[model samples]
Target chain A: MQRSNIYILVFSAVMTVLIGGAMSLTSVLLKPAQDKQVELDTKKKILGAVMDISTFDKPEEILNLYKARVKSVVVDIEGEIIATDDKGNPLIAEKVNAQKNHKIDREERLYPIYMILNELDPNVVEAYVFPMFGLGLWDWISGYVALESDLNTVKGVAFDHKGETPGLGARITEEKVRNRYKENKKIFSDAGNLESITMVKGEGITGLSMHEVDGLSGATITAKGVNKMLKEYLGCYQSFILNTRGLNGIAIN
Target chain B: MSAEATVVEKELKVEKKSAEPFLSKRRKNIVTDPLSDDNPITIQVLGICSALAVTVKLEPTLVMSIAVVFVIVFANLIISLMRNLIPGRIRIIVQLAVVATLVTLVSEFLKAYSYDMYKVLGAYVGLIITNCIVMGRLEAFAMANKPYDSILDGLGSGFGYAWIILTVAFFRELLGSGSIFDFKIFEAIGWATFPTNGLMVDSIGAFVVLGILIWIQRSKSGYVEH
Candidate 1:
């Protein structure tokens, strides 16, 4: 006998509810674990900006290194400390989503800075890590770019992407792309001003320049996005960077 | 759901169970055929997108393989159980929902437990819902077969797809990075001076490897497509 239309409709409705309920429950139940993973991954990326984490084969080592050498702080674009925990440490910076903060007004947005400590002098700051977020050709691309103690030269970089093409723009995640930022100063230009790094797509970067780095060969648009993100973010942190520099007894241009 | 469909289903032999072993001849064929002559990637050319996408590294390829097995087996079992109740017109929708639900759950599990692989696999893991192999097996085999046999078929096809991708990944990782599963074989053996082939890391590498693999497998099995 042929089944009635009502039977099919009822079956679909019941199936939808059942599947939807199961999926929601799974997502809710697993949310904590997923969040932890995200936090750990973010911490690793933050640490990666200051040091070569390629040798860190163990997750526990990364966490331990992060805790030992790194301090998290939240700051406004004006360079003022906004919030800190009971111990006077910054609220876990990983908890603040960079992608979300990238949207909305810049002054209202909370920026996270991971301070890398000197090995010998734990109290001394070795570098300041800044989380960067911006649009790629397809979707969001995010990374950490660390500035040295001088607050001028780039210490290192670690980038990740959502939907960049595999052989092209997605090369941002490669060590080759990241390492190009090393020793390239983003803050202090030849004219001695706070000009962020620009990615030069074409060649002829033979001269040693602090404000420019070679871009990925086939990823000009993505390179431009990175340049834009770095410029905008570094601009936001200018006041804070100048304050920090002034405190170090350096005269600002 | 329809007289014509039921009429077509009768031509295939459903084995009679008696004192037969758990792995019967027919069941063995269900699992093993796809590994060789009936291979999904090589013979049928199914799920090649992921094969090219995730096979850049052996680690992610292995994870993708396991994820596909989980998705396909569960989807086939569920579809087979609901085969009798699903209306003919909406069977495709039902299969899609079942496959999508399973893929999402699997993706969530990967995110929660294996975040690194999840990141590496990225959007490809979710794209498993669109994999023709999952829907193909659902419609062609699961709808007419018992749950147990359907699951075997799923496992067979999943493995078939997995091995080909894994093989592609093995070559890609080895030649591209001079490593296997990130072991850096060349560096370890003092062959660090050897220049790694950059081409092997690109998606084109996957195509080249899979194309050669298909050629070799087909020639060996004498299963020409002509």
Candidate 2:
């Protein structure tokens, strides 16, 4: 049957209303759950840098573990602690969004440092986790790099991406790939210069030096992005590392 | 009043029975033909992009298949229910609206309940909105068929698409990673050093596997393209 213009218009209008209503309703209802998921994922990634979280399948368990073993502090480029935000609210490092901070001026950006404490004794710091953000081949990539208490060696690393080609650039998330950075890799050279770990071109190369790791075979650009990310972020944290070392030395004396 | 209502219901049931049984042979054919003879991927050649993209891993491919099936079935049913009122000029628009709504719902639900799967599927989940198979079945079958028949058609086409991609994934994951569903099968069989085919892990590997599948299926079903 021939439908009049008015009829078509009405039909379209009704469809628009219905579709809009449904999508909005779904978004509103799922927003809380989705937000929680994002929070949990961030915690997981942060914790993943220092320890294996794969076995902790329950969200509550992971959250509980994070609460017990992790403490966070927000630091600036000069490694000074920022106690409050511009509006004077107490700054919580865990609540800081790394991606948003990544776009601002390096000097003004707030960096979150997560301290992983020794499980048996909370007084002893096990490792320090730093969040890194940079551009990948296709889109933004971020990672968590954990430094042992010595402030020189990389304890572990966890990488994530917004959009990277699967099986190639995306392999950065794989344990096998991430292990390249944890194989006795040192971020600081013997001369005490902060030479952040680098992902070299090509894969399966033996006898990698202290500051070098094997790169993804077909993902040279992504590997470079990761290298730059580590270097840039670690450079920002250079003062913090040195300061902490000096403070520890004084405490020991 | 109750007696009269019962008589009316009985007459309606009789009329439905006379018109067509619920599981008629033709209706069964509607749900089965797409599996082989009228396969959506191999024969209709619809939705080949996802077939090549997600088939690299069995786990993600299975999730993708279920998501597609859910979208198609519901889209088909909703469209078929409104088939009569949908004006021909605005039919495509209406169909698109319905399919997009369903796809969004699936994507949102995945994000909420299964965030890990959501991460794994990534943009591919959103890509389901543009999958031609969902739109194709709606236009070709749902627009004219009964709601129940449209659902069956959706199932047929959805499974038709599912099986082909699953087969592709099976081979790709097996050869590419030496694993099934991420289980290191070769290692379990004491072949810890099984050399996986690097090509099979790539997108090009999906094309080769899908091509071989299409060839085998077509030859078996005696379907020759004119």
Candidate 3:
């Protein structure tokens, strides 16, 4: 063939080799940093949901705040707390070290997290922490919420969603939606019962029991899924919520 | 000798006539054209995939648009500079190599410096490689034009795509969140302390945005013509 044909074939081979080399190098080089980012982000999501952290400038600050305010432990099926790793893996008592090994599933280990606000805040009272998880329109919606001792009043709440539409059902990430769980709170009924937060189908939730909130009308399925998850998942810690409520009610009254 | 001379004259005239003034004014054309008469996304419709995703939020869309502008302009300039040396058969592979390398670097910077916006953008940053605008500028005007001209073409096309996207996203986020750039612009009734904000934070919010954008773009620009 002509000179152009020969040159083209050789140049094609050279480019192919270069691109293949770059892709492999990128994967290997970015592995550690990428993994760290993912882990850090996940921790931030969990803590941000439960912690009173509005603006902490650094990751170190976030980690420090989590260390100081949030205490985590493995629990048994019957509300027994275990300081040791539930399934026998050990790195530290409370810290998660993804670098060394993987921790067992939360179900197998029964992980419970408690996050506290400022101890000096005079309004602060008995904190209630519960794990909530459920099916969403597309995937699982899960997170933790902290409420005041009153049980009807919200202290703070955080939520994380998977596979939801951006700017739609995913608006759950916005402060307005997530923070809506604050004050004038509703986690129980006038009957003094724990009914999962329900999506009111009619005329939006107005003066309904603390057990209901007006969910997104068009995205009701996702809202209902979140309701179910928060209810079912928090049910595992029922004895804790009830036992504390019983004790607090007697003392406060 | 007479017949040979005649044939040569005819060949020259045919080449000059068919090529138009465009082929001859290369030196001047290099400095301009992409500004309007040769615009990319509007006139060319190259990149829309990112426009659809990033425009939902203005801040992320701003970052994304800039990153694309940098990649496209530089990719075009670099590709055009090496155009002559590139083997004709392997040109596309070379084009993609340069584009992919740039995209990966931007993705890394985003992950490191602006994780929040990066989260908002998600995989769309990596999807820059597939943005037809970049490749189109590289192949069509960049390859044949001078380095300076290719850069302008890149910028012009990028602006075209960026403005259209921001317009769409501005309306989308404004109507959807009742917020701009995550700041509450409107608070829903009976939901806040001030009663000043209008709350559009419902599922209908997103649909309202999609409807307005589709209607606006289609009706005014003669786009989505049926």
Candidate 4:
């Protein structure tokens, strides 16, 4: 009934080692699959910004579709493409961790842009998707905003978050909520200034203007976070947008 | 000669007890008591936080329930097996270490196999380590019971917790979203105009639904508080 102090110490030591070892082994074994899931999820979000991917059940189908329709490029804050990192590793746009990039200085961040191409005509660009990351009320909120080839009209938007309050700020992930941005909201004004889309105060408000979308009712802080995220990230991508527009022979104001 | 005969008779009785049926009445009670009379969430009032948090929708709640069941069952069995070797002084720590390892395994498995469910469940999966029901069962039943009995107790308590949360989720999802498991019931049945109650989607709705559930379950089971 009575265990000596040494006996107790040895028991606990052994228990700690056994459990820790087993857990680490399982984690290492599962790491590849977990990484693949994360990669697929990010790709799905990027693709979800421009098209409905609900029907794509298999991972291969999604990957193939991405391969066929999507092209990516990593550009610096000044709009110049960076093909590789300083270590000579190829910088793939989909591989860029937006959350990590969000922590870096604005001037030094590498932004990824996914260009959706017309299926029948590869030469015709369809939509451009930009990844946006920022602070939500309780944690980080991120999203993808796809712009029509004209580089002004919003094609679609998909938002995601970590640790946001359910039924409130978490509604940002809902299709109905994301549709607010996709409802013909423009990111630029006629003068070519990057106005960015804004989520106005209060929910269920109709008659939204060209650059305005209704905000979540009880999540003013998160709504503000989304607004600021869009404005800031879009501003960061303004140079790239202008350059691409110019390349397409569209006059830049 | 008489004393030797009595000893033989006692040995026969002991053999009979060991050979008792697997699903004997007493063991069955251990697996059934928590379902109604000794419900973990309603009667015992343990693990109510997750009962409220994850019940906003049915799918995530179902996943949470399964994860909790897996954690509790294994934790109980392991603790019971090590009951004798575990020092009384450090038993709680040992129990915690076992439970934490199991929970981590469950989360990792979920992350690998069911990424969408993992994302939806999110931190709630990690919070299973903190759910008092798992710890309560280990401390109350597993630490002193046989391994088989501990497992049954875990099943009883797990199912007890699962059903309660699932019930809460059913109503919340139905009323909040006009759907079951994200399928729009109203839209499918030609009643697309059914307006969902926003309150049901919030945590307060969970509280309301659980309160009503507890009330109904207790009244039916005739469980009275002192």
Which candidate number maximizes TM-score?
Answer: 4
Worst 10 residues of 3 chain A by lDDT: A93-102
- For residues A61-118, could you state the per-residue lDDT of candidate 4 as single tens digits? 9999999999999999889999999999999998798999999999999999999999
Query: In angstroms, how far off is A231's CA in candidate 3?
Result: 3.1
Model 3 native-contact share: 0.16
Name the runs in model 3 displaced over 4 angstroms. A1-17, A20-47, A50-52, A58-61, A86-109, A121-128, A131-141, A150-154, A188-194, A199-208, A217-221, A239-253, B1-38, B74-104, B139-149, B167-226
Clashing pairs in 3: A49-A158, A186-A210, B55-B169, B186-B198, B187-B197, B187-B198, B187-B199, B188-B198, B188-B199
User: TM-scores for all candidates?
Assistant: 0.89, 0.92, 0.68, 0.95
| Stretches > 4 Å off in candidate 1 | A54-61, A84-93, A183-186, A202-208, B1-19
lDDT of 3 by residue, B128-166 (tens): 999988988888877887787687677777776677667
Candidate 1 residue pairs that clash: none
Mind listing the fnat for each candidate? Answer: 0.58, 0.54, 0.16, 0.58
What is each candidate's DockQ, to 2 decimals? 0.51, 0.57, 0.24, 0.68
Error of 1 at A187 (Å): 3.7
lDDT score of residue A252 within candidate 2: 18
Most DockQ-accurate candidate: 4
Model 4, chain B only, scores a TM-score of: 0.97
Interface RMSD list for the candidates: 1.7, 1.4, 4.6, 1.3
On a 0 to 100 scale, what is the lDDT of residue A172 in model 4? 90
Q: Model 2: per-residue lDDT, tens digit, A53-164?
A: 8899799999999999999999999888999999999999988888899999989999899999999999999999999999999899999999999888899999999777
TM-score of chain A of 3: 0.71
